[model samples]
Target: MRKYPIGIQDFEKIRKENFLYIDKTQSIYNLIASGNYYFLSRPRRFGKSLLLSTIKEIFSGNRELFKDLWIYNQWNWEQKHPVIHLRLSKLDYQKLGLYEALSIEIGILAKEQGVELESKHLKGRFEELIRKASANGKVVILIDEYDKPITDYLDDLGKVEENRSIFKSFYSVLKDSDPYIRLLLITGVSRFPKVSIFSDLNNLNDITIHRKYATIAGITQQELERDFADEIAEIQQHQPDFLGKLKSWYNGYAWHEEAERVYNPFSLLKYMDGRDFRNYWFHTGTPTWLVNIMKQNREYDLENVHIGENALSSFNVEHIAVIPVLFQTGYLTIKGYNSNNRLYKLGYPNTEVRESLTDALLSAYRNVFPGNDSMSVTDDLSESLKKNDMPQMIKALDVLLSTIPYDHWKAESESIFHIIVHLSFKRLGFDVRSEVHSATGRCDVLVFTDRYIFALELKLNSSANVALDQIFEKGYLRPYQMDARKKIAIGINFSSEKRNVQDYLVKELE
Candidate 1:
């Protein structure tokens, strides 16, 4: 019945309080022995700070705190090194630029070690801190959210570069103190390219997308059941099906081994606390900032879905000589990869992220209204599915055609009009295709149900005859006409001037 350190990132505080902790120490134990400087990139609140604290604990030779834990019995506890933990995320992102923020961070970590930075210059101050740690013995460097400042200023390219410059010099100090460093482990939301933040330390091992350790930071489903079973049971008491709810809300993050899945640790805990499956993962971090990056780059697609790796990863923010800022930021993650192709499928990491992102996109990308409007339009299609009403479905093209927002085009919303209609009908369980090829040209939309295929064209102040003729001349419905399902040609004209469906046309294809 110990307290769970829900958002508490400090190891000492959480440990002394006897809070519930799922052991992730083995990875640290392995990591320390494995490399001198290790860079790990995980999503926000995936327990990076806690991991940093855990490293501090291990390095301090605080073996007594780890009784019955995996590392205590597994590791040789005879060794303990002096640890210098610098938490960088604590600085105010808006109030200070990179230099000032680094100064504050250095001062705090140095204060704990009884060595203050009396100098104003960053290099001079960091030199003093490193000297203190080395004077005591090699420092075990642990930095949390190392990229917060740059990421905060992602919109302001000026600041991203400034922050990168500041960190480059700051982290380079580690290279100078390479001899005194016992184990250097830095955690951030995403990995910067070698030339940027870690410029001074090119050899820094980046284990962000490394398949071997993706599970190190987040909670495994097994761990959740084992450590928080009671909490889950407690939360589920109000729900008829708690397990299903948990799975749907939180069970879709996969980060390793070609095929691995994980729940978002931050969201999962809060959901346990409130017993409501809120978007605990998006709790004011990662998503919107990522959305900003997309908006700035104009890379987020409203119409199509992409599954290729490096699709969004190629856009580099100015003055940043590193990995694509997007991948490091946790908005995009490796989905699946083929060894032969060296190609990876990148996507939003989990079910919660996908749905949360979709909800955000629906609001940001499209103008979808709430509720079952699609069912009203497709009830006949639904019936057609049941009764196999190809004839009725093909004939219903006229009625379906009538649903276009003709006024929306004259209004000139551009992409908004097309995106809304496609998403609207997509909700009805039809494979909502957009920009489909036709005899006259490309149709704006083509919704295909089990019973019939629909070809639609949307335009501002365009007539149904033009939309329908495009369908007929371009042979938009020709490809699907031979299918067992009835073929239907429907032309929809949208008025950009207004945002509602204005006119639609439907015709049967042989």
Candidate 2:
């Protein structure tokens, strides 16, 4: 049996070589039937390229590959049309400057179809191809990774604008060529089009948050069990805890309002191949341009990333701005959406994403938390909680905080503390949150469990008495007093000049 199409994105390559194809043909049928112009935003390595390649196959009229798939059974293969397949990712996104890159891609498409037209740039050549493709009849246009170039220059506004304008002109041709086009499917990770690249194409439909097509790209757990069932057993037997490990490391993506979650298909299969589940997804694919977003917004909480009473609808990209980047480049995702509220809440989709994010964070910071450090923090935490050794936890926290790498510490101290403590508790398998706000005021750290909720207030230089006074005066404990389970308020002060605790006050609410 052929290996699954783990990284292969070409439909022709996968089918011609007889690779295992995840039958996402049904989604293709629905997508095509629903609209003539559609766009989808999904994370990196979630099979957007493969999906586009499959579309290319359908339009190229390659009927053999579809024979057993759902679309083959359903689509009228006889009605296939000429296709204009433009995959932007195949070109060098970084090296080829914008004008040059788009021009080359246009040349490639023309060359592929034997449409030899000499044009200086994309607009003129693109016009010629659409005109030629239309002479025979309307054509199917599939553009893959449409925003890769713009994402490459996000740090520089001028370059981003320049590329966006170039893309806008290039894609605007599609609108003029629309009457002669049978269908259009544009694939990327975001729907926010800041440059107005697709402004001329008003009929475009964005299925980025559409629940029905949620499983269209990623590997659903059900698909994993059905198609790669034996592989799971193979790994599980070698390590009794493998299934749990796999789930912890590679599962949990919530793209659909209805579907539970999914794993990064690319990472899962790669791990299955090597019998080692690691951060494969981060290794390849577009470098996290989202890091720019995180860096720009330096104080974002790492803990509340995937957990809250409700999903995070706090962010949205401007359609003409670099919005398409996050959607196409694959950092943020449409997790749960509320049509009534017209909101899209985004977060990590699976275990692969979370672990990969942790690794990426460390890499981005270029510093690893000492393994022994986490143990020391835990031991100190236990001493503070169980033995009322507040000074010990405070002193340890000061040392940890002071030793923080310059890159991570460059962020706000609050943000740094949140990242550090959250990473620590994440290793301990507890849900942690920083900056917990109540109606009256906010607590610094809050850890919730089935039996207890710990409300903590940290003061780096303030007196312990002042910290304790604020807890009561601000009514931090009042909010949790009504809970049946216990709630504890901790007031700790750190030495302004050293890695030792100045004082501490701990209290329990009735």
Candidate 2 C-alpha lDDT tens digits along 1-510 = 438777788888887788777788887888877779888767778898898888888877788987677777677777767788887777775687767877777777777777778666678888888777666657888888787776656567677778788888878887777688888889875544522788788888876656788788877777778778778777667687876777767776656667656667888878778877666876675455564345445523443233221222112333222223433445444566556665555654445554455444433432442221234434455444444454665665666555555554453343444455554444344456766788878877776666677777766666778877788788876766778867777777665455345677878776
The CA-based lDDT of model 1 is what? 0.65
Judge candidate 1 at residue 217 and give its lDDT: 79
Per-candidate alpha-carbon RMSD to the true structure: 5.8, 4.7
- Which 10-residue span in candidate 2 carries the lowest summed lDDT? 306-315
Q: What TM-score, over all chains together, does every model reach?
A: 0.78, 0.82
Alpha-carbon runs more than 4 Å astray in model 2 = 93-96, 118-121, 235-248, 283-289, 292-296, 302-340, 355-399, 405-419, 426-428, 449-452, 472-487, 499-501, 505-510
Q: Residues 292-395, candidate 1: write the lDDT tens digits.
A: 34433434333333333444333356544222454455545666667776565555554455544544443333222222133345446446533544456434
Best by TM-score: 2
